[model samples]
Target: MENKEIILNILHEIKNGNIPVHTDYNLNLDMWADLIEYMHDRTYIADVTIYWFGDDDTYNDERVHSVNLTKVRLTTFGERFLTEEMN
Candidate 1:
């Protein structure tokens, strides 16, 4: 899915009180981290913690790595964005 769509899904899931939303999409860990950061950066979400599992030195390599999102919730702006999107 596109970034926008994925973000919307994330917001909606959070709005519905679904913590730590999961996606079945085959996106890489970096992509997920980027998306989470994107939402947080834009103030759409707050109190988010992203856990990165892997050594920093091998971050760019093909080694197995993972990212987990926690404490994520939709901010007021996120709610407004979702409402506007539905219009």
Candidate 2:
């Protein structure tokens, strides 16, 4: 699949804060990380990270940023991505 398609899919998950386990996706899949890096730079994703702040943990920070948003409520990037608008 092309980068744009993959990016849109990933964005869908990010907004919901419902990231599944790595098993849900191909760990060895090609261009997955590339998609992330590309989104990291090209998109204006809110730094809105989700954390697992339960009482039984004090080690790792399960943090992630927002990327996919169907409603396009925040900024121009989400709007552009959702609408696929051109300049």
Candidate 3:
């Protein structure tokens, strides 16, 4: 998917309030390694986090790290998406 699609999807996910997804929701579903790589480069997130994936394995051929979301929030973006979808 394109960069625009990526941001839009991320925003949509955020609005949903829950990180509700199938067990197989792809983090690296497309040729979107740039986004994942960029996230991996974050300083603060890396500091407080152990591993997004359960294992300590490095980001391999798989595009995404598995996330065990403890708490998910509904951002404004997600609310809009849901509102529009419901309508």
Ranking by lDDT: 1, 2, 3
lDDT of 3 by residue, 3-59 (tens): 445544544554454342322335442333344333334310121122333344674
Top TM-score hit: 1
Model 1 spans with C-alpha error above 4 angstroms: 20-23, 52-68
TM for candidate 3 is 0.34
Candidate 3 regions off by >4 Å? 20-65, 72-87
Q: In model 1, which residue pairs have backbone atoms overlapping below 3 Å?
A: none
In model 3, which range of ten residues has the least summed lDDT? Answer: 42-51
Best lDDT among the predictions, by candidate number: 1
| Candidate number that wins on lDDT, 1 or 2 | 1
Q: What value does the lDDT take at residue 60 in candidate 1? A: 54
What is the clash tally of candidate 3?
Answer: 4
The parts of candidate 2 lying over 4 Å away from their true place are 20-30, 44-76, 85-87
Please give the lDDT score at residue 81 for candidate 1.
Answer: 97
* Order of quality (TM-score): 1, 2, 3
Q: Is candidate 1 or candidate 3 better by lDDT?
A: 1
lDDT of 3: 0.40
Task: Write the residue-wise lDDT of candidate 1 on 6-41 in tens digits.
Answer: 888788888988764445556666677777778999
Worst 10 residues of 2 by lDDT: 65-74
